[model samples]
Structure formats: C-alpha cells, structure tokens
Target: MKRKKFASLMPREALKRSKSAPTIVVIGPSTSGKSTLVYVLVNHRIIGFITVGIGDKSQTTIIPCNFAFDERIEKDEHFAMRIRIKDFSAKDVHIEILEQLAKLFASNELSTEDTLDSIDVEWFQNILEPKDAAYHLGKMEKQISIEDFKESIADVLCAIENAEPSFSERVKVKKKELAQQKVKISEIRRMVFEDIWGSISDDLLARYFKWLDYIGENITNNLNLLLGEDNSLGGIHDYSANEDDIFMYGGTILQTLFDPFEPFSLIVEDITLACRPRTEIITRSDENIPLRFCLRDTMGLTQIGMDSNSIKDALDIALNCSPDSILLLMNLEERDDVIAESCDAIAEKLSKATKLDVPVNVIFTKADRLIGNLVNKSNKETVVLKQDDYDATILGAIDNMEENIRGYLTKLPQKNGMWLSLRYLDEGIDPIQRALKNQGSDKFERFTPTGLYQNIDEIIRETQKRILPEGIETPLFVTAIDADAPAVEMKVEGKMISNIFNSIQNVLTEDNSVVNGYTITTKYTLSGRSVVAYYNKLQRGQGHTTRANVYGNFSINMKAMLNKILCNEIPDFLTLYESQVIGTVVDNLIDIELEHLVQEFDKNQHYKDLAFCDINPALISKWSDKQRNTQILHQAIRQYFSSSEKYYMVMDKVAFNLSYGNEQIRKIIDGVYQKPISYDQTMREMQDTFKKIFATQAFSAIIAKEIGDAMTDLINKMIILV
Candidate 1:
C-alpha cells in the first residue's frame, strides 16, 4: 500500500495567484501553538517545541526559511527549526545528540593520533635495520629536535622533488607528521573548551544557577507557563519536573551542544532587576536557523510600577512587528482582575494608535480547572446517553459562557473585536495547533469528536476575504423564528428582505442607474401571514395547527420614477386644465358648437398662462387683489371659462330659459338688465342714472351667476381629474 501524505494540491493557476498571498500573524499565549502553526503552514509537519518567554516567541518561520533556500544549503534549507526552549525533554535529546557527535570527533582524533605515533616508530625501525645502508635513521629520530624534525622532512622532500614518491612512502610520511602534531592538536581542543567556559566568571555561573532555581519556583507558581504543564506542549511523562536546577542544567547541556554553531540567540532580562540582560547560547551548526524564537516572563504590572509610559513600552515590544493578529494571554487561575485590566488598557491604546486591523485572540489559560469541573459533573449523570448528547450540552454551556463574556466585554467600549478561547488541556494535540494547521485550507471542515479546530477556517477565511478584493459572493439567508415555537416554525420568512431591498435602493440611488441608464424597478409582494400554535384540543385535531393566507401586494417606485410624475403633472396650469376638460367633455359634449372655440381659446391662451403663472407674486398682494370686486369679476369669468363650455354658451341658455319662464319672474329679470329701481329720478336725469346703475349691477349679477355655474363645472372637472 502507498504511504498516505498531506500536501497542498493547489492548481498551477492557483499557485500563480498565491504569489501575492497576504501575510497573516498568529498570536496567542505562550503555549497556544503559534510556532506549531507556522510549522504546519510551511512544512506540513507539527513542530513540538514550546516557546518560553514573551520576547522569545517565533515571529515567522516560513519566510525566513524560504529566504535561506536561495542560499545553497544541505537538505533543501527549508526545514523549520523548533525554537521553543522550555520543552526540556526534547531539548535535552537534541543536546545529547550533538554532545555525542562532539565526543566522537574527540575520540576519533585521539585514536588516530596514537596510531600515527606507532606507525612512525615502525617506520623508524625499518629505516634503521643496519643492512639498509640508510644514515642512522633511529638516531636521527631521537636526536632531532621537533623543529629540526620538521626542517629535515622539508629538505628530504626538496631533494626527492624530481623523484615521485610512491603511495606507500607518502602514507609513511603522513603517519609520522600526524604523530608529531597529535599533542599540539590535543592542547588546542582543550584550549577551545576552556576559552568558552571561561568567558563568564564563577560568580556569574553561581548566580545563573540561582536564577535557574528561581525559574523552577516560578514554573511551579504558574505551572501552565511550563511546557507540557497544561498538556498543551504534549503530555508529561517521567521527565516532568519543576526544578530551576533541572532547567539550568538542561540549559547548560544545550549550550554545550549548540554553542559551536551559533544557530540561534536570545537575550534574557530580569524585569525586577532593572532589566539586566544575559545571552543564552543556541544551535551547533554555523548556519543560523532561519527562524529564531524566544519567550520571557515579565514582572506583574504592579511590580513594574504600572505607569502608562512603561506599559506603552512593553506594548511596543509586544507589537513591534505589527502582527496581523494579537493574542492576549490571560492566566485565568492567577490575578485575573489585573490581567483583565491590563488587557483593557492595552487594547484601548492599540486601537487608538494603529491603523492595522489587529484581530485580538484572548486565551484563558488554566482552563483545565474549569473543564475538569464540567467533565466531572457530566460523568456523574445517571443517563448513559450518546457521546453527542454529552458533547452538545458541554458545548452549549461553553457557548453560553463565551457569549456572556463577550457581552460583558462589549459593554467596555474598548473591547471591540476581541475573540475568546479556552486553553483546554491538550488531550493529544493543542487546540490552537490544530487550528493553525487547518487554516488556509479545507482539511478540517467540520467539528470532530474533539472540537480542536472549531470555526478556525471561518475566522481565517473571513479575515482573508476582508483583505482581498476577490468578488466572491457569500449568500446568507435569514429567517426569523420564534424561539418559543418548534424549530420548523417560521415566524417571519425572508427576515433580511428589507435589508436586501434597502441595499439595492442604496446602490441605485448612489449610482443613478443600474448598469448605466437601465433603471431598476423593485416590487414587493406580501406572500402571506401565517399563525402556528399548539392547541390542547380542536374540533378535529389534537396536535398543533398551522394556518396561512395571502396578505396583499405593496410597492414603491424608485425616487427617479417618482420624479417623472412631478415633471408630467405640475408645470403648466393650462395644460392641466385642457387635459381635465378634454377628458370630461370628450365623452360628454363632443359635438357641442362651443367645443371648437374652447379648444382654440386654450391653444391661444396657453403661452400667456404659462408666463403669468411663472411669476410668483407676493402672497399679501395676491390676497388683497382677490378681495376687490373687479378682480373678483375677472376671476369669476376666468373660472367660468375654465370649468365648462356651457359657461361660454350661457347667453344662449339664459335667453331660452327667460322666454319660457313665468311672466312675472321673466319681467323682473328683464327689468334688472334695462334699468335700476330709483325712487328719485327726474324724467331725463333719472333715466340716465338708472341705465348706468343697471348696467353696473347687471354685469355684477351676470358675473355672480357665471361664478356659480363655473363652480358646478369645476366640481365635475375635479372628479375626472382625480
């Protein structure tokens, strides 16, 4: 069977596109698997190293390793080095392996040097065999000073220059030279070790040992700070120990192994002692590890005299690289109040100062204590339900807790965008480690028996989507359901329909067109309203009932379309009048003789009305003029003509009516037009005065009748206009 393997299988086209993949920063607490994530991203392998200090954590492993690939190196140069210094067991093994190599080199050199001395003795015996006739070779070997021995060898080599030395002769000469140089080489090796060990004073070494002991105590005080303490770095076997002595011893052994190569370096400072610095040795190879990571514990904020300036300095160091993501480490088991307060301050400052959209991931370390309590309760339950039953309850409880914390945080005003995670005891692998490995890929798509990688892909994908301009549409449909009802009950369908409509409206209004001049028309229909409820007993049924019916249709045009209504209706009063008149009279009095005259008068008066209506007179003057009699007469006549054709034919109708009316009323009507009733009128003067008064009064009466007729016509015209 073929061995299974995990590798990125991006298409060639996808690979091309990935050339500009955005950078991502993985930030979390010390044991939250930031380094492991970088490992999996580049090497498809898990790096089991645990970083120790805040400053010593890995920045990036992939980019540096990739850079090293350009420099020719053995083994592809892309291998990721685990920079976690606190994983003592693994570090110990690494140190032991290198120490063995160093010992092997020493042992081989010593043995070879001894063998060369014996060979030189044998060569001297061969040269001094008495019958060989060579010049006193044994005496020469003893009597020659070391400097003279080297000179004689050089002279013999010059005398034999034309004569090619045989392979056997060359081997003999090489053995003798190796024998002479053996003691000097041994001294040189010893001197090298001495020089390395002597760099620090005995007092300094003693202090380091004491500091190492203190570190062990600190680890016990905050055990989660140590590798494998919370099971995050891996399980602790017999190797688990909280002793500063052991850590320091381990460090010494590590230094001996790696100091030769200068693979990595870290500066350690004592926060309580004015930040006194010390350098630690790492790596044995001459070439530096592509990535170097470090970790350091700082004094508590109170211990450090938590001034704003000092806190800012620490934050600057923590955020030096402007990490795309920030992990705020909070030890739940420690002074949580202090941690929470510090985090709030840091978050506030970061948000105000930086334009970088740093997503903060908060790790509640020592979560095992909380988890253990939950698990114990779950186990003691009487029912032996399926695994999912237990898991669902636990996850639901956790989710509720998470939501409560989020709600509390959101109220702070400074805690926007902070995400939370519990640092669960690593049963076999770190949850954060699994998250980092599964991100940017589709391997772990669902929640497994263990929710190690829960929602990781969602977070990463969302962040990437925000950064990239790729036009990927994600369709989200929301249907609001009443929680009191069954899951299948849909209280409000298309809950986001209003939002969708608004979005479309916004787009159209902002752009003035959809796809340029192709106006968008939106229509909404009320499908139906439905009622669902559980009933104890019904006429025919015992279970719940669901009822649905059609409601109605409702719509609104785009503002642009509404503008068309205004443009067509409000400008010219004459056009509006003619439209109303044609609509009414066209059906009522199409053949009337006055119809042509009405149409002709409207055509001639159109331009004048347009011009006069355009002038917006002062309201006071307009109102005052309306109260005068002549103005009123003119208005009444205009209204009459505007209302109906019968106003224009009023003389014809009035003459016919008057002739047919009762004689007495007809006489009164005709007398009013002929003369005014004047009590004191002289024969000639009275007739003139009566005629003048009659004409004025008659005109007023005629106008008043016309006004009444026009009002009747206007009422009828309005019905048609509406």
Candidate 2:
C-alpha cells in the first residue's frame, strides 16, 4: 500500500510559531456516545458532528485518539481564520477512572491537586511503536506455524460442519483448553516483577491485577461472545474485506486505515487517556489558517473499578490547561430527576476542579430520543409531519430541558448551557452549527493564585480599618493625681497591661466567624506604648479619667442609711440605667451590622481556597493582633457602667438599715398641728430639708471615687494577665 506518515507530536519550533489553541475536554459517562459524536464531526467538515450510535453494539475505544482540524469562523471579518478543534475519545481504562472520580466528586472528596505520579505523556507514548503498512499486513495471518494453523482451522471447520457438537459448544471446549493451558497468575506476576517495568509499585500491580480479573470475569466473556458470533466481524466465513486488501496493496489491517467508509473499533477496553496534539492547515476560499491543538478524551466518571491514578492525571491536566471552557455532555435518555442530580454533582466537581471561575457549557445529548417521542405522539394528533404544528411543542420541550439544566447548574459557581441531537438531520435546525457558534468565547477570566494572595492582602487592610477607630491613638483612659505620682498613662505603659487591646485582638484573630471565607489571614497589633502616651496627654486636660471618693470613718447610722440607698435597691436601679446606655450604643452603630461587613468580606474571598490552612500564617498573625486590640477597646466602653454596680450594692445595703421613721415624721406633724394647725404644709417643708442633706456632694463623690478605682484596678489586672 502507498502509505502516508502517521500523525506524531508537533515539533517545538512549530509549536512556538503557531497560535495556541484553547482546549475543551469532552467528558461524560460510558455509552453516552462521546466518540460517535467526535467521529461524525471529524468526517463532515461542513456543518458539525452527530451522536447517533454507530456499529451494531458500541465497540469500546482502545486508544486515546486525536482528531485535530481547523474549524472555519466565517461570521466576523476579524475572525477569518479557522479555530483549532481537538476531539478526544476515552478508552475503557480511562472511563473506569472517571467513574471513580464521579463517586469522589459526589462525596466532595476529589480535589484539583490530586497527582498521577506514574501516568504521563511518556507513559502513553511508549505503549506501542508506530508501524507502517508492511508491519500491520504481516499481523493479518495467524501467529502459530503454518502447519498447526491449517490443522486447527480444518478441525474447527469440520466441527462446525458436522454439528455433532454445535459451533458454540466447540468454541467453549477450545476456550476451556486454552484456559487450562494458560500460565499461572503467580508465574505471570513473577515475570512482570522481573521485567524492566518493575518500577510499577506493588500496590499498583495489585490494582492492575484486580482490573484484569474484572475484565476476565465480566467483559471478556461478553466481548468474546460478540466476536465469535455473527456481529462486528460480519460472520466467520465472510471474508469480503479481501477486496480492500487487494485494492490497498496490503491486507485487512492496512485496508481499514486507507478506507474512509470502513467501521473500525478504535475504543480500547483498557489503558487510560492521554492528550495527542496534531497540526492542520485549513484552507478556505479566501485564506489558509494553520492551527495547532491537543485533544484529550477524558474517561467516563460513571463506571466501576476505576483507577485513581488515571483520574488524578485527567484532573491535573484539565485544570493545568487553563482551558478556555469546559464541554460537559450528559445523556438525555435518563429521567429528569437523574439528569438533575447528575448535573448538580458534576457542577460541584467542576466548580472545585476549576476553582469555580471557568465557564462551563452543559450539553444534553440523545436529543434524537426526545424528537422521536414528539413525532410518535404528534403522529397520533396529526396526519403529517408539520413544522408549524410541532413548533410550540418542540420549543416547549427545549425550554423545559434548558430550565432543568439551569435548575441544577444554578447551584454551581458558573452557569452556561445548550442541548443537542444528531438523529433528525433532515430537520431545519442544525445543532452542530449552534454548538460551534458558541465556541468563540470572551477573554479567559480567573481568580488566579496571585489574585487570591492580593485579595487576602486587601482583606487584611479592610479588617485593620474596621478594628481600630481612626485618630484614637490611645484606646485607654486613666485618671492621674498630678504631673507625677505615676501618671495614668505611664502606669499603664510601664505595667505592659493591654486589657482592652488584647481582648479585641483575640476576637479578631482567633474567631473563625470573623473572616469565614478568607483563607489567607493576618494578625493585627496595637502599640501599647503609644496608647499609654495618648492616655497621659488626655489626663492633662479636661479630657481626664473619671474620679470619685470612697467614704471613710462612717458612723453606724450613716452606714445604715448608705446600705438602704446604695446597695441592693441602687444596684437594680443602675442595671436599668446600664441597659439604656447599651441600647443607645447598639442603635448608633446599627449601620455597621446592616452593612453586612462579614458577608462583604466573604464575597471578597469566594474564589480563594476554602480552608484556614491555605492562608499565609505570617499575614494572619499581624491581622489577628490588631483585630483583638480593637475588640478589647470596644468591650471596655460597652461595659463601663459595670464600675457603678459595686458602689450601688454597698449604698443600697446602708440605705436598707436607715429606715425613715414614721415617729419622727409624726412628731414634726404634731408640732405643726399644735402650733398653727398647718400640718400638710409643714410636713412638705421637712421632707425637702431631709432630701437635700442626703443628696449632698460628699455622698456622690465618695460613691463615684470608689466605683472608678475599682474599675481601674480591674482593667489593669485583666490587661496584665492576658
């Protein structure tokens, strides 16, 4: 045969000169007709591809095939060149990995960082040597010697002809003998271990063995049945393919490659998928555009006994590609509920894999089935196929399909979708063209790793702003006796106590709720020395710390009166006053909470990694310190009224003992009545005099001083302790 050079990896210089193509990995479940669509698209360059099943039963692809071509963009004058198209079809092994990946995706265990240490381009390239016509033709004949092969063929023919033992029975007997004569699995394992490929880990070897066992038990039996029967091979005696052999100047192997119309089983039942890049020169009436691209037909994530390593490889490559878009194909034959569930699961997986920013185009395949249903039902309603009559129904169906798709994908980070079918090509609408039209995308946008770091830095800045109020250098207020006598500021600074600062800093730093979505965090700190200095400056002016006097040398009667007015009763009264103060503070800052600061902060970090460990620790430390200090200051002011509670308690007890005697009041009333008979007027005068004496400056000063001192001591102690 006049053979042409087979496709190979593009040269480095050629790659550098050519425009880079955007890859869109085609992913779906097995038997979803992924390859069939690819086949149609590559063969017909006019409109696009179809997904109608080809061959009797679907033949699995054995190799990851690449179909690279130039898709002409004729709409805009600016886009006259052909867009590179790479379509990849997965093998059974790759499909299995995808299935496992789907399970992990559903459980939310899958991550984009997963690695396939042993699976790479080199691994795939080394599987088989590229051969030409002569080598392939030589494989057409049986492997055994001529004599043995002829004898075996004659015996098989005789057995079939006699029907003494039916063809199936004879085949089974041959299979049984072959199985009995086969090398032991243990011996094969030893041989494999001794081979140059011994670098394959024992764990991987075990998995491979398990996979082989599965194929032997489930797939091999069924595939053998198909091959031995009147199916893909077109019956045992039907050797009509010989005509192509003569025409191609080779044999069956060479003929399949040269013939365009022949059905070839390219699907591998084993082996994982890998990318294969090709170059093509697409010539138009106006110009010729040379394009370079790679197509990777990812495995179906909806199968059994999947390989984790392969799944990891697929995920790693897809994510690293910075793919301009993703084409997610789902089979529409499933019920709406199933489709919705699958969409939701896949959307979550894709969101995590793509970091929730890449645009995804959801495609619903098997539209032909829906069209058939519409036609069959419509036939009952109308005599002929009329576009006008079915327009509303078709539109409604399409709308519903899109709605269902959107409903599930809405939960995903990104939303983009379309539906298609290749069954009714005679119809007016062309889905392939629609799909191709949607290919040209806007700029590829993503919140990159660097962007994530920048976002964290921004958050730290904003958090710093919110933590400490502007122009408030000293968050603490302390009363001083004079210029010396340990100025309040000096005392606070020398003591190294930051009760207010530390408390606030702790809240901002340690609390996860403060910054839920920010993975990169920072700690905030307040300058203790600066705060003390600020407080001391304030003490020198009218803006001084609160001061009060604690009463001393009190008589028993005075104590009783104080207890009655200042301890129990006064404490309750003060609580009511404190509540009012707190209420006012909350009301004034209502706008802060209403603004949804946390929500805004979270939104800022939405594209970033979700967990705490992903953030930079050094940044987090700085942010935390500052936040804690601010929170502590806020709490100090918020609960300032607590200082008065102690004084009120002491006074209330004294007041309880100092009962206002009715006898004394009666005597005064009696004297007034006896003298001028003006009892009511005289009684009012006496009451006013008593109130003045009890509400003197001395009493107020003492209580205020006691409360202030108690509070100051408590604050200082807390700051130092932390």
Candidate 3:
C-alpha cells in the first residue's frame, strides 16, 4: 500500500522543479535509443515519452527535451538524489536554439514554473540566430529569393496535381501512405497551410512575408563565399530594426512553425523538437529525492551534414552545454566502419568543444541481439532456454561485447566502455548509473578550467614540435694538411696554401670545436705514395707502353727503320721513368686534394657532388722537368741516329761486317761460338750503354719534357674522379 501511494504521487512530483539536481548530457549516434533510454529512466515506462511516435522514421525529438527523476542513496546518511535528463532533438539547430532557451528559462525572473513563455528574444540572438538553419538560410538568401523558393514549391505541387487527378484519389493514397509515415505532398501542405499557418497571428505573418522579401531581393552576390565562410550573413543584424522581425527569422521558428518552402525542401517539412528539461521525482529508501539532468541528443555525426543542415548546429549546442560528462552511445546490433567512424568523430568533436577534459563514456546499446550467440558459447545449443537463464545470457554476452568495444574505444580518447540492452533495463541500467555517479567524484576536477588550459597548452606545444624549421642548422667547412712533406704540400710561391687546414688546427688547439662560425673538418693524407703498387696503375694508364724501340746510328737508306725503333723503344723507356717518378708525385697530390673534398662532403649531407682546386702548380713544374728530360732523349736519338753520317756508318757495318765470305761470321754461324761470354757482365755492359745514352743533357731534357706531359694528363683525370 505504501509503494502504491508513492507511485500515485509520481505525476505530481515530476512536475516540480529540482534545482539541486546534476545535469547529464546524453550524446550518441542517430537512433541509438537515447530517447527511449530517458523514458525508462524517468518513468519506468515507454509511453507518452514524446508527442510524436518513437521509431526510425518518427523520431520527433529535435530540440533539447528534458526529463527528471529522483533516486535515494543509503550512504552514511539517507541522501536523496535528483537527476535531470536532457534529451536532444534530431535536428542540430534545435539543440543549439534550445540550449539557450533552456538556460534562460531556468534563470528567468518570471519563470515561477517551467513554461514555453519564458523562451524569448534573448534566446533568439544568443542562441537561435547563430544556428545553422538561420545562418545558412541567411547566407543563401542572395542565392534564393522568395520567387525561386516559391517556384520550386509550385513545380512540386504541379507534379503532384498531375499524378493525383482527383481530390478523392489524393486522399486515398495519402491515408494509406501516412499510416506508414510516408508523407505525401497534400499531407505536407495540410500540415503547413492549415495547421501551421492558421495558428500564427497577423503580426508574425507580416514578419514572415518581410523575411521572404528580404531573401528574394538579396540573391547571393558571391555564392562561393557564402558556402565557405562560417559567418557570412552577419546574423540578425538587420533584424534589430524590428525585434519581432528577428523571431520570424529564428532558426527554429522559421524552419519549424512557419516553413514557407515545404514542397521545395524536405527539411522544411520535418518536425523540429523544442527540447526543454522536464523534472521528475522518485522515492528510494523512503525518501522523496528529485533527480535533475539534461539529455542532449544530436543529429548523428555521420548523417547530419550530409543530408541536412544539422552538423554545425549540433557541434555548437554541444559546445554551449559544456557537459560535465558525455555518453557516447553506439549500437551493438550491427558493426561497420561507418558506426565506428561516427563514434570516433563524435568523441573528437567533444574533446575540442569543451574547455574541461570531460570524460567520454562509451555505451554500446542493443546487447539483446547477442543473446543467441552467447547462449551458443555456453554449449547449450541443443537445450531449450528458460527465463531463469536469461541473466546468464545477458551477462555473458555483455562481457564479450564489452571486450570487443574496449578493443575499439581504447583506441579512442575516452574513459570507459560498457554494453546495455533496454530489454533488461532493470539490470542493464546499472552501468549507466555507475557512470553517472562518477561525474560528482573527485577525479572530475581534471576537466575543470585550470586543467583544461594546461592540457591545451601541452597539445599546442606537441603540435609545434612536429614541424621542422629551416633556421636550426650550423654550417661546416673542411680542409686537409700534408704539413711535413714539401713534395705533396700545396705551395703558392714559397708558402704553403694551408689556411683551410690551419683553421681546423686552430679550433682544435684552442679547445674549441668551430672556427669563424663554421665547424671545421680536416683530413690529412701522407705527402707521398705509401706503396709501389699504388704507382703501378698510374704507370699502366699514362706512362709505360708494352712495346720497346731500338735507337742506333743507321745508313741513310735504313733511317726509316731506325726511326720506327727509336720512336717505339726510346719513348717506351722514357714512359717507364714518367710512370715511376712524375706519375707517382701527381697521384699523391690528387689524393691529398680529394681527401679534403671528401672530408667536407662527409660533414655536410647537402653537398652531393665534389669540386676541388686544380692539381698543385709546383707539382706540375716538377713533372714538366721530367717531361723535358724524356723529350731530350727522343731528340738526341733521332738527331744523331737518323742523320747522314750516323746512318752511313750503321749501313756500312751491317753490309760489310756480315758479308757471306767473311770467315769469322761463318765460324760463328757454324756453332763454333767460344765459351759463352759472361752473361752477367754482358747485361752489365748493356745497362751501362743505355745509362750513358740517357745521361746526356740533350737526351734527359727531351725525355723529361715528354714524360712530364703524360703524367700531368693522368693527374688531371684522377682529380675529378668524385
């Protein structure tokens, strides 16, 4: 009897205002059963939750709809808790407009009781004018005139008139379709002209006409600008001329009550929810406690802007509420990337919207669908399920689904995640209740003003670090030193050109790392070749040739043959000397130069190619002397051996000394050769003869000049081998 009496007072208690109740904003995707959840939470019944039917197509909750209930907690003391649930509208603008309306209504001086009369002009400018509906229409006003909007409507009406020839034909079709929520043109016209327009006063009607005129007169001068700019219309600026005129252009008012473009735009015919907070009372632990909260619904993040003008308004309303705790409701009955993306998009938007680090709690609804799967997992597939086992099924399924949701929500920036089935609301709502309780806990301070500012700063700093700037690098210079050896040292006149190398030493000796604002690197190569094998390659390339030339005095007629031998053998000998001496010196100089160039390259990644100074001129002068010597040898051999006197003497010896009748020649040919002459002594004599030939100044100059030219050519090629 006590329970019965308390139940009877539910209606009366629900009507009273509960000022101390905490506000909870319900945010989730479209048709996530947010409104239904509120109905059960407040009244433990689903009936009369809203004026319109509840389902996929009949979701009429377009504004901030408020519901309240009471809960009693038996803590150390019996504390009664009043909870307020604010359910939002399907359209985003409605939430934006209603948030302001609800706040003003709550704080109004004349609001002795919660009533629609409290919603007024301050609500229009601060809230409704900034919303997408009014803002977008105002922007597009220049693009759309009253005539254009009316003409589009006329075209639709004309098409409908042709399709439905008679009034009875239209009525029959409308009745059949309307029963299923399939609206027809005639039904929409009736809803707009008869029901909507008939209720407005003459003054409001005049204002509506004037707004239409304003749109027609101002066709968009820059449609592209209108589309891009967020604040293009300068909202409600001109409406200040007549305060009542602003109301006619209110986002909710113009689009909801007196929609003038019903036939042209599908959105114009849609219902607009006037979401207001409703308070209710409940008795727990024998205490009557009022629970005050606000439920804020938004157009699905994925759906709102794509098909309607609700995206901007939805975000604005969310920002305005400054929700202490947000509930991200996801449906568990289906799984897809779209659903996941919507959840992610909403979570990100909420994080950016509030200054507080408000916690986002993910609630996966419709867990009942997983019952069969859970039952199968329990190995009871063949067994008939009973009512007693329902709890087990729900528990098992919720545990599994929670793990799956956690897999996803963990990746998102949210706090906790849970699953619920409205069918088991008696037990299912426990998770939601626990989440709601967290909002009042000590940890909630992390989302306060000071905490938010610190978090924002950290985020900005981290973002800055990710971008690299051009101003942070130090320039580097490099050089090399062959300090001890003069042969390989780079000499500009008597002084070595080692300033670059000196810079490196100065920095190192001074215990500093850089010189003249540049980091200096130095590489030192030995002044001379370390191994003979290193000079062997230089010999093969530019100095030595395989064939040898024979140079001697010859008769005039044999001069051509001697000249061929002299050219081939004499130059070949000079080439060998060129390879051993001049070639080695030039190669050493190039190696040193390249070493410095390479050191510079290693220190700086920006230089991809190498360019260095030409081979040292002093080294070239030394090589030129070698070339002159080789040329002298060639000149002496050619001039002495190819002349008339030397040629005649060579011919006379070949012709007369080797005559057929000569007895000494015959004896040598008859294998009567005396005991072989000392082999080592003959080789020694031949070497002495060649030494004496080249030892002449004329011979040395010719060979030196020629050999030097060849060595210089080799050095020039090696330096550019970058």
* Model 1 agreement with the true structure over 1-722: per-residue lDDT tens digits: 33222122112211221212222333333343333333222211111221121122322111111101111111111121122222111111112222332233344442423322333444334433223121122333433233332232232222222224532343345445456445344333332322222233444334333333332333333323322342232121111112232121122221221221111211111111000001111111112211111121221111121333444434443343222334344433334454456555665656522433445444344344443344445654455434343343445444544564564365344353332333333423443224334343232221221232333333433433333212322211111122111111101112223332233334333544432222212121111111001100110011122231211122222122322322232222243233332111122222332233233224444423542453456642565321222222223334434443332222222222222122333344334322211111111232233223323424334322432332333222111010
Worst 10 residues of 3 by lDDT: 548-557
- Best to worst by TM-score, what's the order? 2, 3, 1
**Cα shift from native, residue 411, model 3 (Å):** 1.9
Per-residue alpha-carbon lDDT of candidate 3 for residues 1-722, written as tens digits (9 for 90 to 100): 24322222122122232211223455555556565455444332212323132445522333233333333211111111111211111122322432443344324421323323443344434432353332233324334433433332332232223332333354555466456555554433332222222233444344434444343234232321322343233121110112243211223222222222211121221221211222222222122212223344432111233111232234434433333345555666655455565555665565543333344555666655554456446645457764334444444554576677776675566545655554433323433223223433332222222222233223222222211112212111112232112121111110121332233233323433212111112121111111111112111111111211111111111112222333343333333332333222322334445445334323352222211125455654665443433333223222222221222222222222222112333233222111111112222232233233333343333333333332222112112111
- The count of backbone overlaps in candidate 3 is 60
> For candidate 2, lDDT tens digit of each residue in 162-275?
344443354455445446557443332222212212232344334333432332233223333433433232111211112342111112332232222211222221111111
Instruction: Candidate 2: list runs displaced more than 4 Å.
Output: 1-19, 31-33, 43-56, 70-141, 144-292, 299-324, 356-358, 378-392, 427-722
Per-residue error (Å), model 2, residue 286: 13
Off by over 4 Å in 3: 1-21, 44-51, 56-58, 68-290, 298-316, 373-396, 425-722
TM-score each candidate: 0.26, 0.30, 0.29
Ranking by lDDT: 3, 2, 1
For candidate 3, the lDDT comes to 0.32
Which candidate gets the maximum lDDT versus the true structure? 3
Native-to-model Cα distance after best TM-score fit, residue 42 in candidate 1, in Å: 6.6
